[model samples]
Target: MKILVVGGGTAGTIVANNLARRLTAETRSGKVQLTMLSASDRHMYQPGLLYVAFGQMTPDQLYRDQASLLEPTIDFHVDPVKKFMLDKKQVMTEAGKIHNYDILVIATGSRIVPDETPGLTEGAEFFYTEESAVKLYKRLREFQGGRVAVAIGVPHKCPVAPVELMFSLHDYFKARGIRDKVNLKYYYPIGRIHTIEAVAKWAKPEFDSLGIEYETLFNIKEVDAKNKIVKSEEGIDVEYDLLIVVPQHRGMEVIERDNLGEGGWIPTDRHSLAMKGHDNVYVVGDTTNLPVSKTGSAAHFQAEVLAENIASIIKIGAPVRDYDGKIYCFIEAGRDRATYSMFDYETPPDLKPPSKPMHWFKLSYNQMYWTSVRGLL
Candidate 1:
């Protein structure tokens, strides 16, 4: 059977590689043909971009050649998927090629939708993309310090990123000896700082101690860049010398145009990572409408389950595995320290509350990063 994976970023690369390794044995030889289609040759470690913005990581460390990372046996197509022809079980690329597959995995991740909000695309500076982050960093270094506002648009990837930016900016200004001259504000439409109640509870005390001003339920209506002001739906105008925006997010357009997403994200079985409507289609990572934070660790966990399920289907023609929705994130709070939380969906009747490890855990994890690369790749 032929399998087509329609992305080459974090989720796509991991799934494809895992399948290649599993199906390489003599017993499964010639039984599967794996192909990965992506729009660009650059594979970015997206999580590292946040550090890049803070001058913590260099640009070279954030990228790798997509072609070099894939297994030699797997076919890699560098092209954008134009549409999905479910009727024919084929995917059509912008280059006019149709790839037929017995099984299709829709791993196309979400994208930032700045244009969804009026004036945001035209006025505010976005830090979601590498190019934007670089530009913003340049502007930030030259900034003399004043009213700096970090606003989060609706439905953002890595929800904690805005808060991280807030903390880092606090540290940035304090180190520059202009903490007194700078006024920092964080605005979110959500009533709480984090979507997870437990995390929000843990973070509230930190915000209070840091003296960072925040406004909740404040939806930005427009950015009057010419006037250096952000107008909210609540009739509040926030003026800023520098505006850092986390733009709105949406599933890949190919998913929406082809009616693949249920609510701005592909609806997949939380346990199986399989698309609800299509038996042969599986989705992993940020594209899914799972009620969890979209992070790389979540993708890695989902990929592990997805690879096993695909192997089971090919080997025994049965979907025997399920995902547990397990995710762990290291939230950096600057000052060479970080906080972390581990969550699992398959807990027993009652489990203990989430635990927050000290900065030492994060420090040790940084060393483990090298080990992870060695083991996974």
Candidate 2:
């Protein structure tokens, strides 16, 4: 059996590593072959980008050589797939090489498209990438007492990030002793402060306490950079001295180009994580159109379940597990305090109060992320 895993991000890496370990015997006997294809040779801890924006972590600390994180039994390649010939059970790479597989795992992650919104790329400061994070950090430092508007775009990676960014911004300005001078206003495309009801309920009071004003149902339409104004689709215009935006996201271009899914999100089974109508083809992470946050935690959980079922099918002639839509995320609530949310399909997350200990745990998890991706946690 040949297992071809694509994308090399958190989801792809974990599933590939887990399969490599679980199928070690079969692989050694040449009965099963595991391979991974990724665009980059380096694997990035994406959650750390938030810290990078806040100056808590540098970009260099967030990466590891992709090969260093993989198990020796698995064959890994940096060539990105350009074509998905699912009917032929093969993929053509950018380098014009063809790879055949009995099973395919598509974990190609999402990307931020600020340019989708008119004038947003030029007018807003977002920290989705390394360079953007550094640039935002510098912008935040040079900022001195003005209207700091934080706007959110839909279908973003982390669902809780808008609230988290608000909390962090409040703390950042407060720490700089300019909290009184900075007018922090938050805008959301939805009807609430956050998409998660529990989080919205919790964060609203917190925002009020911190004097963070908010306006919901403010979908982004365009930015008038010259006038320092942001116009919403609802006919409301907000003038800002500085704008920090959480841009919308879409899946990789390869997925879109192949017409595998709308906006590159593959239609996947909620439980089995397999692409709809294609049992042998699986999807995970941001590539799946799952009703879950596009966080590393979701990818990690999905990978575990998907890997287990695949390994079980290989070993026992039947699959053993189902993904329950389980997702866990740590919410950094600022001021050296943090909390977490854990939920699945059948249940909503119950948020706890932020605490210093929880904050410390989140900090430690930044380093532990590498271990977690290695299938150790």
Output the number of the TM-score-best candidate.
2
Evaluate all candidate structures by whole-model CA lDDT and list the values in order. Answer: 0.78, 0.94
Which clashing pairs does model 2 show? Answer: none
Candidate 2 per-residue lDDT over residues 264-302, each given as its tens digit? 899999999999999899999999998888999999999
Error of 1 at 109 (Å): 0.4
TM-score of every candidate relative to the true structure: 0.91, 0.99
Residue 261 in model 1: lDDT:
82
User: After superposing candidate 1, which stretches have Cα over 4 Å from the reference?
Assistant: 26-28, 262-264, 346-377
What's the C-alpha lDDT at position 314 in model 2?
92
Which 10 residues in a row give candidate 1 its minimum summed lDDT? 347-356
Find the number of clashing residue pairs for candidate 2.
0
lDDT of 1 by residue, 169-276 (tens): 888778878887888888888798766666677667777887788888777889987888998888889988888898878888888888878545988899988889
Q: Per-candidate RMSD vs. true structure?
A: 3.1, 0.7
Clashes of 1: 1
lDDT of 1 at 273: 87
